[model samples]
Target: MPTLSAADVRAALLAGAEIALIDVREEDPYAHGHPLWATNFPLSKLELEAWTRIPRRNTTIAIYGEALGEDLAPRAAAVLAALGYTRVHRLEGGLAGWQAAGGECFIDVNVPSKAFGELVDATRRTPSLSAQEVKQLIDTRADIVIVDARRFDEYRTMSIPTATSVPGAELVLRVRELAPDPATRVIVNCAGRTRSIIGTQSLINAGLPNPVAALRNGTIGWTLAGQTLDHGASRRFPEHVDAERREAARQAARGLARRAGVARIALHDLRTLESDDRTLYRFDVRTPDEYAAGHLPGFASAPGGQLVQETDHHAPVRGARIVLADDDGVRADMSASWLAQMGWDVSVVEPVDARERGERGQPAARAPQPAESPTVSVATLAEWLGVKAAEGDAANGLAEGHASRAGAGARDTRDTRDTRDTQDARAREVAREDVDENAAQRADEARREPLAERSARSDDASADVAVIDVTASANYVQRHIPGAWYAVRAQLRDALTRIPRARRYVLTCGSGQLAAFAAADLRGLVPDGASVYVLDGGTLAWLAAGLPVEDGETRLASPRIDRYRRPYEGTGNAAEAMQAYLDWEFGLVEQLRLDGTHRFEVL
Candidate 1:
């Protein structure tokens, strides 16, 4: 019941304390970097199934997650104790404390998939170069391409001279697209930090050819260094546009929409349709919290990922068009991008011009002029931003929809009511069959186990057991223990099919590594009262212990990569995005370094 410090945990490690170090971060973050000798049981997943993974019922369970430096440590400790972990203890101060105390975090690059991700980040390293350095590099004609990695509008507002707009996140994927010449030296920059630093690191990790770095401190740095920023750039439409700006962007967007053959609807159309309830799905593709606070009264929020992931589920009207709302042009554009790609007859239903606030009263600031001999057209930029905004919008929309759907009106009620009823009926039937079948199967499995071994794992956890076998399809079909079925990590969603209505579920993976990931993913799908678990050793250990082995080919094939494509699909020039992303990333690193708060761990 005592709290454990990183130092205390270190002592435990040295003394060989029989404790499992659990990372409570999301699966992707865990895959990126985590404590050595620690197993991942994402906190989200652990809340529901702690008993399944930590069934010792007596050993101390230690939990840690991201470096927000808050009370998650104690909170997790409390949750564990409540779950009957008995002597649950918090890792004092979490991973940050562990790192500060010279503890090691581990990164395994052996797995090609995970290694690829790290490489993408590492290869795109863009350290922030001082303004003097940038000026010096440019003056000397040192083969560098200066990229303004902020929004194109931001670039137009005020940016370093000769800088092109390349946003973050797109950095890794769009590098070559921006600077086609492999030998070009790339300088990425943003208004400030975080995005720039992450962007730069992402490219370096991905292994870009050119030497990349950021403009230290970004545009602020440039101005502070007595370097002039260009104010003659064209404006990118604002999220909440004023009358003048709104008119400008509207006119511009109208022209573009006409070119794309898309019809634009006003807010009146939105309101008129809202009351009709005619299977029309209105989406606000903004951030999750934004969608939650308040949205157009009739809209069902569907952030980008979920919107796209369950496109057919959320909006079955393949032919039915969608109206998008966003204060910022970014969300609308990004969400539209994805919806367009998903074959939705989608268009940015720009907010009514009456609600628009033009930039008339705002102080005159530096804005980018339309390029005289421009390499990229405004129309091209609009298309790019529009698409990205749509995708981003969809993501934000999906996050909001997820949060709101818990309380919102039944979406697709007409179709879902029958499906829900059928599923419920099917669940009851399945439970009845499972009870009888599992009872007989349990008897047979009981016969294989040594008396003592059976008792060791068979505490109440196994009685009303729900087994989720997280492995390749081939592995599961070949010879999973009787009821164990496949829960592919990537398509882990499909695992919902096998879930029993009346039992606690326990997930198993190849080496216990993926078991934790699966359990975390499947946590949401478990029935209202059922608990979930992960087999400590997975199939490897089960087989190592001489358990039965079955072999059948799995249906698993690398799923079509097409689904992973964003809706507002564009073949983003990764270099440009990488540059923009690095601009923010390096800026963040510099700030963190200057503030003396960034904690880096040697893995």
Candidate 2:
């Protein structure tokens, strides 16, 4: 593969040339440090996600990773090449090389969004309330309403004592109804800080008469102050706002977006930019459920809160133009304003008719299609693993292909079966238990017991089928098949050497998409007589089938570099790590100024 020096990547970014500065490492290590514009497209997921994320196959691509001298970077370049990416090149010395060349390395994820929040706080002097002060108000039953600015599921996981989930952009549309009286105090919070600051500032920008403030440092500050959080809380802002309030909020939000240099274009005007060579992303900024019911022809569903939190994910190209659509007007404007301040050429489509919202659910990506691989249903795989049904699960087999099939007989939380919320929740549960020694030990013991003793079929039933899980290491350690081995997709040939050879091999991952590609690759690695098949729908399907899952690191086949525990997430973080995270966030604004690539202009 050809190489690009760190200086070359820097020059390309500065010149505003179309280039993808990619980090091929998993998200965990990628979050620890990376270049400002480097989007993470892990080697483990190259075949599954690269096409949708990078968009143009022939675009300039500079790839880097911690495993610079190893087969990792070269292997990644080869994968991209196989996908028809013609200009893929390795970063001369990787991240350290970038640092040596005076490229600043930012620690933590979402640097662009969080740094912009700090700039907003500094310039707007966004008002805030300490944890103690907020706690006092809650104790006194004062005329105050606390609203969480995170997603509804995140709010449900942990939130203030009595906070309602309004999410970020919903603050303007819903806060008026939430606190009708001008004297009613409103406080906003998120897991950490950015969303709260943006949410609180959103209300202020909309010119709400009510006194507005952010819960300082959000829930992190609350916990550090020795306060408690309410788990599984379901309080939510009213979905239906009074018509008069909605119209008022729309005008207020529009004015704020206009002040921030966000353009307002009619829905029809969106066509003019479609033919431009520049990347243009059209997203419906309404809530997921709202977008699912109806949305623009080619637009994808990206709730406003998540869109702001993950701009690099939604639009990886830094110079890409973004167009947002929301029927209510409040969400698109509030979301677009923040994107504009963060140096995005964002616009909102006006007068979007009900007719335009003809397409439903999420839009499909125009990814390259590899030859489809053979698959075995989750129940069939379970049966092959010598796990007999418990008398009542005779009809538990799900049909083959995609999410809906896997979700059909979902054992628990079926409503959220296909959403990222369910997947994140499952991953968190696995991570949390893996860290708990008592829980991990108990799970290990349970899995160690024989699978043959209670099996209706002979032990030979499982002897010939070797199951390999290609999901993240954290998820693999927490939940997997009784005898399945865990391995990174990139190192399949190496991993297969370590595992006992079987006549037939089965591969699985989070949703089976990655496994499908890995299975195809595995077919080439194994002997001619050996059979390779993907577990239909992957691990999620296995979970939905309510089949037995063995937790703990039973069949260790790979290193655990796939997931990095964020200091801000969950409740078991050490005091030092949490405090250090807050301190790192505090210094971001200074770093943004020093970097000089960010074109942020606070409104």
RMSD of each: 27.6, 5.3
Candidate 1 lDDT by residue in tens digits, 332-413 = 5443443453235666666644234222221211111211211222222222212111122323332232222211111111
Residue 244 in model 1: lDDT: 51
Candidate 2 lDDT over 129-167, as tens digits, reads 999999999999999999998888778778899999997
* Shift of residue 535 alpha carbon in model 1, Å: 16
Worst 10 residues of 2 by lDDT: 393-402
Clashes of 2: 0
